[model samples]
Target chain A: MAVEQVAMSSPDERITLTDDQRRRRRSRSIAIAVILAGLVVLFYVITMVKLASTAVDPSL
Target chain B: MAYVNDLNATEPVPGVSLATPRDYFELLKPRVMQLVVFTALVGMVMAPGSIDLFSGAVALFAITIGAGASGALNMWYDADIDRKMARTRLRPVPSGRVAPGEALAFGIVLSVGSVALLGLAANWLAAGLLAFTIFFYAVIYTMWLKRSTPENIVIGGAAGALPPVVGWAVLTGAVGWESLVLFAIIFLWTPPHFWALALLKEEDYRRANVPMLPNVAGAAVTAHRILYYSLILAPVGVVPSFIGLASPVYGVIAAGLGAVLIWKALPILRSAGTDRAAARGMFGYSLVYLFVLFAALLVEGIVARLGWF
Candidate 1:
């Protein structure tokens, strides 16, 4: 039997993420990305410096 | 259906006139996704070597998608029980905002899409871990354990705890002791963390026929269990520091926070309260403790890499 669509109001009201919550989450994500990017670049530069200093010394 | 008719005809009405695709998206519990992503990211960071921006973004994206897929699948499986519980009754499927079939389809699609993409962007190992995580949560935890035993959360916590391992695999293409420690930290953290809330909402669990620890074992037993696990968890949480992945500062903070976690569990172990203030306090502090410990690890990791330590 095809049950008729019940007309009862929903017991479960959906809770959407609020604009403020979205903004906070977004900003936090961007901050983490920035920190990660900064770390990568810093690593690259340091590795390059150590390589260059070793090349100049050519001993030990 | 009669249920839908009754819902449409009820008092106070629903806050939204109709649930769109986005509303169904919210039902996937995106907040939980954020925590998973953060822990996974920390695990990736602490792994040996480094990743370029483009590859890192791709890895994080794959992880996020996998997490979202898991959430959708969880909602799909639990839709029936969710409708009966006051806490989960308002979820999209239970509330009639989204059909159950739609959620099932959404989850399936994300699951396939994320795993395939992860395999391409990261490594097969990481992708395999993602696949396993999804199956573990949706099948093992949801379909099997959730209805079977009071030990459900204890055993099922593994699914939730694998993100860091997934994160580590993304870079190294293998699981090592370092990532294992991260996994252990979260694995041990989950039971005490969730049981506190379960204690607070014992009645809700009972109403839904879900055999949470407090409902099955009594509040005193549940509280004592929480204390025992928290004591073990505190020392386990600090193991990474001794292994050279973290600094002394992480050790000190972890010990302090671990002490505080035990302190929070102590009151509840002694007495059950009508208001749930102790459970609430534990729940809140647990969030802060995990966040602080992970953040400390990240800071120390960066400093050590920079030779500032």
Candidate 2:
């Protein structure tokens, strides 16, 4: 039996992810989360450093 | 086909992308990024100034990402030729591990983010240079020069040599003569270095129709040209000592290294070009030559910064 394009499944039927696709998606998601967290830390550290430099020196 | 169709469709599909994080990382060309980061670090250290720890760290990070972004864009654009070249056949984009759109998007995002971060941490000049380097690599070299001329690497090399200048500008907020000295070494080093590998990869480049020196100019001309470049590179290699960037001892060491590099190239010229063993030896030594030269400069920078000298 020829399966129609799975992408057009009825709205009520949720699409099922293949195991390989799910695994890859999960790994990518974790990587993105780590990178985003790293960015947050980076911004935090930059702010502190800038604040400290200004506090230590008020000279023009 | 269905998956590809789903991806490009106007309505969002529920299918998950098969690209893994590692594939994305591979798209960055980590090895090239490492060299960019190292040279930029040397440039920063050699620049006469000071940076806070945080800002310095951020500058390096931004430069690294910028270099990787350019590498990704190179891969994205060259995916067609990469598929043909044995050396580049397994690259993420060519291997189908990452989609072309994904790689392009990844490169664009990193390029913008890196340049913005650099502007905040360093100065506008550094950021501008980084942005220019990306554009030069992705557009000027990859899109234009790479296909049309055998002298592609000779000119495209400028893009690679700009990292140290960007690094110097990060700390100094302007280009300096000392930074240009670093840039000159890389600019001169590039032709001989790439031509040596070009001799080895002649077939691969021919298959890809990339117009590498050997593919267009023949092996004899390529080998002779390599010799001429090496001859010029030898003296330039030791200019740091003459210019006060390094101790006289470092100069002597650099000269000795240069002599050995010239010695390695002799067999290629003696054989009337394309001596396989000579090319292999030169390729290996060329890597060591650049690394040691930069390492010596890095040591000088460290010693001067610490007042050990």
Candidate 3:
């Protein structure tokens, strides 16, 4: 009822979102989160690889 | 289409606006960011030392994000002044499509994240330069100098000019004379490029109370300044060739481009102070001059690497 009331009030105060708009927003948020997580993983992997490459060989 | 309206809404939306992804992207000033990325890439390529593919890619990505962060923060802080300028009135923040607070937060997060990642991926020297660049643009230039001084663009130009140096540092883990030359070219070119626009938009700048050169000094003074900078920039454009950083062919191209830029500025100098057409032509040619100068370097570097020369 509040949403309906706000919708009916005025053009400026009301920001009506269709179901599709909401869905797109949710998807964009998820994509950003996933990308951030991927970057963290990448940094970790690269650091480990660099350290391992510089480590002394035990067999030698 | 389905529509819903609130009849009583009269105030500005308080972070409740439906901003799409594109609005957020626009806040990054993608056009400016593209030039930043291109110039940075040329610097990296022209550097003497070689960088591994993975490291180079990561460094470039970090620099790109850092450039975007500065753009976002600039928009956040300049929203009020931007609203008064015809050229910037339609930007995301001034256009009411994005919340200013959101832009600030986005900028800060990206700024920190990009610098840290760049340090980890490449070296701290490059990261330090990038961090200082963001600070210079956001705080020194945007917050302080822009409103306070007519020479704001001259000082703020340092922020834009440092990308090449940052890129060179990423590759060599140090700064060199070559990178400094690249930085100088852009630094000197900035005044003529921006002041030409200022000449045309003098009224808009006056309305916003921003102390652009044309607003503080008269148009004749601004035109003379543009000519002075352009004359200096023309010779500096060919410095890379003299230093052996670029081939002689690049020297010829740079000289010709610089000549064209001088020719463009001549009209602005000869015309009456109110000549928008001359100012616009100079502004447009300045863009071409910088792009082609860098493009020549990029092409020459590729040719040398391929042994095609």
Candidate 4:
């Protein structure tokens, strides 16, 4: 019974869950991470575009 | 106008919150400060004036601090509406991380400190503009216009657009058409940029009872307004190049981007679903537009200094 209880707990206390629960949590985290990463990339692109638009001639 | 939050006396404290120092800092709205600092720096750079490294640094610091002060005061005043909005719910006063009184005090201190620093490091003209900018944003924009009308952001944009003017003043100790043109660029840019955001977050504004364009006007009207403004913005963007502050290179780019902006806006006016994509694209492009325009001016200034022009 003790071994069974131990088996029920995942190794990662950060997300203590059954195997199925662990799998779902992991997927959700990946999705959120991806979204955040995408937002960061988008922000970078916008910044670069802003920098590029302003080239001017010396006379002007 | 609600300089103090009604809920400041009533809301329960949050279990999860930042420290007092963090909350105070948050009240300044760092992102807005960043915009203010950048525009002001660009204005300083593009102006026909000279400053040693130390004085220039001091001037920039003063302007940034002044911008931050305005943010603090805006936060101090808007704590009530902020508490009501999910987006602003986590702000210091709303979340009970910092007391309204503390935020108010912080703003007042920074406001005075920034003005004094600018006056000492730069000149009275720059200092005066900084003071006016703070008042214009905190009092005029936040305290008065924010809750009064749907056109609040439109009119309030002037305060946001003044940093460059303030920078120009710092360099020349006077105003000129060039700085005014820079001001005009931003003044025109603000409506379309914010209207798009307002269109996207109409529900949030409605819940908060703020009179953002989308909440006050129907979607169709808001879309029309966006298109109308973009149409104006498109042509006006080319003026800097014509005025000799920028080159024809900037002119061509501005014209190209302006056309795209107008194109993006057309579908938004015709239908609501397209509003989001259009708004997002416009808002994103608007940043690029201003950045490019300023970069052009900066390049012109640098080249002229190097005797290349």
Which candidate should be chosen as best, given DockQ against the real structure? 2
Clashing pairs for model 4 are A54-B292, A54-B296
Each candidate: RMSD:
10.0, 4.0, 4.4, 13.5
Model 2, B1-309: lDDT tens digits are 122223332222334355788888888889888889989999999998899878998999999999999999999999999999999998887776677888999999999999999998888999999999999999999999999999999999999999999999999999999899899988988988999999999999999999999889898898888888889988998998898878898898889989998888789889867589899888889989998999999998899999986
Off by over 4 Å in 2: A1-15, B1-16
Report the lDDT tens digits of candidate 1 across residue range B120-201.
Answer: 6667999999999989988999899888898999989998899989999988989978999998999999999989989888
Fnat, 2 decimals, each candidate: 0.22, 0.33, 0.04, 0.00
* Model 1 alpha-carbon miss at residue B67, Å: 1.2
Computed on alpha carbons, the lDDT of every model, listed in order, comes to 0.79, 0.87, 0.87, 0.78
Q: Which segments of candidate 3 are over 4 A away from where they belong?
A: A1-24, A48-60, B1-12
lDDT of 2 at B231: 90
| Candidate number with greatest lDDT | 2
Q: Which stretches of candidate 4 lie over 4 Å from their true place?
A: A1-60, B1-20, B272-274
Q: After superposition, how far is residue B140 of candidate 1 from its true place, in Å?
A: 0.6
Worst 10 residues of 2 chain B by lDDT: B1-10
lDDT of 2: 0.87
1 versus 2: better TM-score goes to:
2
Candidate 4 residue-wise lDDT, B1-309, digit = tens: 112222231243232122334456687899888888888988888888786566677788889989999998888889899988888988877776566777788799889978987886678999999999999999999999999998998999999899999899888999878899889889988998898888777788888899998888777888888888888988988898888877898899889888888887887887862458777777787788778777776777778777886
TM-scores across all candidates? 0.79, 0.92, 0.89, 0.77
Candidate 4, TM-score of its B chain:
0.91
- Per-residue lDDT tens digits for candidate 4, residues A1-60, read 000012224453231233433454466467558756964664465444434443433341
Return the TM-score for candidate 3, rounded to 2 decimals. Answer: 0.89
